[model samples]
Target: PSLSLSHSLSLFLFLSLSRSVLSPPASLIVSPDRSQFFEYESVSLSCEVQGNSARWRLKRSTVFGERSDCGRNWGKPQGSSCIVSLIPSHSGVYCCESGSGEHSNAVNITVHGDRVEEEGG
Candidate 1:
């Protein structure tokens, strides 16, 4: 019977591509989990998404290295979180992408400088 209808259409296209490659993408969370920062303290970068309505972007890299785009769109409410505020060059890696694009897994920040040293022996 046409080889069992070509093996049931190749097992329904391998179970619809294994359920769309295991289906899991769209969730971002960033907290002060040792992603160090200092200097005029005021740092908050949060992003979370599960399904629909997500837009958050903040990029920074200085201290002799250049990268721009401090903010963009940034709209996420209803349980999710999106907050941004950090100065002192806003050093190093920070990433968050959504709106169906799905990208969030790079949070390395280090903004130092709160020096205080004056003692003579």
Candidate 2:
């Protein structure tokens, strides 16, 4: 299959950035390390970096809006993440931003089911 121009450009950019001297973009880390979660639980998404979090606000993309900043109404910004009170509506991709415009790679969060079983013994 032929790659669309937009897809080609995206691939090029992804490759260029991957090879660039710049550090890999920041990342969102989940405490449980599990993408799946039960409803009504607290899900914490922390950034890989510390310090200077004033520029950081959890970002989410939606079908209606390409991107939107997570508001304090849904969760409180603590340290490097927006600690959201997990609900089904919160299931989506999330990322963190810094003052320099360096945004972390997006992480997918799934909030559904009844309860999350602990991993490992």
Best candidate according to lDDT: 2
Summarize candidate 2's per-residue lDDT along 1-121 as a digit string, tens digits: 3569889999999988885436644667777778777787787777776445566667876433557675644667775566777877777777877767777777777777455343322
Candidate 1 per-residue lDDT, tens place, 1-121, comes to 9999999999999988886467534434555555766665555565553445336544445556765544442222224444444555666776665545556566777766653421222
Report the poorest 10 consecutive residues by lDDT, candidate 2: 112-121
Query: Ten residues in a row with the worst lDDT in model 1?
Result: 70-79
| Model 2, residue pairs in steric clash | none
For model 2 the local lDDT of residue 113 reads: 48
* TM agreement with the true structure for every prediction: 0.28, 0.61
lDDT of 2: 0.70
lDDT of 1: 0.56
Distance from true position, residue 59, model 2, in Å?
Answer: 1.2
